[model samples]
Target: MTKPAVDLIIVGSIGIDDIETPAEKREGLLGGSVSYACAAASFFSHTGMVGVVGTDFPQEFRDTWSSMNIDLEGLQTVEGKTFSWGGKYHDNMDSRDTLFTDLGVFETFSPELPENYKEAPYLFLGNIHPALQLHVLEQVREPKFVLIDTMDLWINIAKEDLEKVISKCTMLTLNEYEAQLFTGEHSLTKAAKKLFDLGTEYVLIKKGGNGSMLFTKEDTFLLHAYPLDHFKDPTGAGDTFAGGLMGALCASGKTDKESIRQAMVYGSITASFGVEEFSLERLTKLDRDQIEIRVAEFKDMCKI
Candidate 1:
């Protein structure tokens, strides 16, 4: 029997990480942009993940993605070690230092989407090299909506290429610092104005725990992060938000302004749960019912 069409495709790095927080440290954890985003998106849509790993990757992690029903046909496994990173978070939980990095097989990553994924309705370019993001875009055929996330590294080194990627995406997601770095404008409004000149239809600036703000040619929208007594780890929260946003858009079957507004809230709530545990532990345990409860509770908090 033929398989159903995939609603979303996410492309990014897949890695194993050693993380040290003020409280403790863990090694060989499943972590990466694609891993976090794909898992979160699976909760709301039929998602396909495109990334490269190594033979050293654990079977149990593969089993986890399988359990989420994420399409793995685009996942490539090859010789060599999986990309690995080590980080230590400070007492504030807002700042972290990279202890080490080993590119391993990831240094040569080249995303090649499955034939079935070429026409996916939604595509998310997770934080990866701009050239790679462009490579994936070249393969996709007329995606209904495309979202691209970038970092300061890309803005500093590949400004020209990153600009091209932004021009093609329906929305661009980045932190406030990255926005200023790319546009040289201290005011976020002016920074967004420069981005709009680049041709993206929308811009979403992530403020981490403070919450997020959305910008368009005509209006701006704001969302508050779900209140938490505290969160254990924040490694993948941003990726989770991006994935959830794309997934919610797919679930709604519309990309109108109202749908975009609702999807932003869904994305924020999903990331809130992810930070409660280490690695992907909390997100792996998340279910649709739990998400619905919090989404409603969040809406109630906003009502006058």
Candidate 2:
């Protein structure tokens, strides 16, 4: 099959992840942004990645993306060590504590888009420096749809830069807490409205167990979380959601309200799988059929 002209380009954090669970503590695969985003996006469409990794970043780790058919041409390997993070998850599995962060090459990272990736139709700007997100946007020659995610860190320290990035994106996805932090408001509705005013036509607020909400100037769609018996890992779940949601949108070849709704279901289904196991094990094991089955189940729950 002929290669797609890079359906989606993901720009965000990339590094080594060290995870700890109550039942088991391991220092294996973990990080943020690009890792989770690219892992999920690889499932539905062709994807390219942009992030910084240290020389110490394992070959096996980098090879995983290529093995999954994701293009990592934009991944930069610096002279120093790869970014490493250690975190411990509570029994609840929904929250975690950061034990350590070694920025390595990611500390002074600067993104430069690849030749073939500059014109991607779909773009995902993972949580990073908001200024960096805008830098990526400036590099994109023509992106039909751009989805950007942010965190409370930038909301507190780089609010202005965050707004600048939000002003350019077509869609913005953040957790309820981040929304509140960004807008300096406790009300989610008000926070989303503020975000809409910033520039995004659509906004998605992710709530841990309570479910996720999608808002646009025209309407609102709420997606109930798929009740799971147990969750082994919550790490990178939101980024995974953004990846799957945007992946489905890119795959559907539509940008309507209905398509965004469908993409939310796709995101929830994909994230449900992410929490079932650590890292990409559950995600990698799923084929298109299995994903469709879960997505259909989510639709049934939504009465879609």
Pick the lDDT winner: 1
User: Once all C-alphas are superposed, what RMSD does model 2 give against the true structure?
Assistant: 1.9
Q: What is the overall TM-score of model 1 with all chains considered together? A: 0.98
Compute each candidate's TM-score over C-alphas. 0.98, 0.96
Candidate 1: misplaced stretches above 4 Å? Answer: 1-4
Candidate 2 residue spans exceeding 4 A from truth = 1-4
Name the lDDT value of residue 26 in candidate 1: 92
Candidate 2 lDDT by residue in tens digits, 182-271 = 788899888888888898899999998777999998778888888788878788888888898888899898888899898888877888
Clashing pairs in 2: 17-30, 54-82
Report lDDT (Cα) of residue 172, candidate 1: 95
Question: Which 10-residue window of candidate 1 scores lowest in summed lDDT?
Answer: 1-10
Local accuracy of candidate 1 as per-residue lDDT tens digits, 1-304? 2443688999999999999999989999999999999988999999999999999999999998999999999999989999999999999998999999999999999899988888887999999999899999999888888999999999999989999988899999999899998899999899999999989999999999889989998988988889989888899899999999999998898888789889999999999999999888998889999999999999999898
- Alpha-carbon shift of residue 158 in model 2 (angstroms): 0.8
Model 2 lDDT-worst window of ten = 1-10
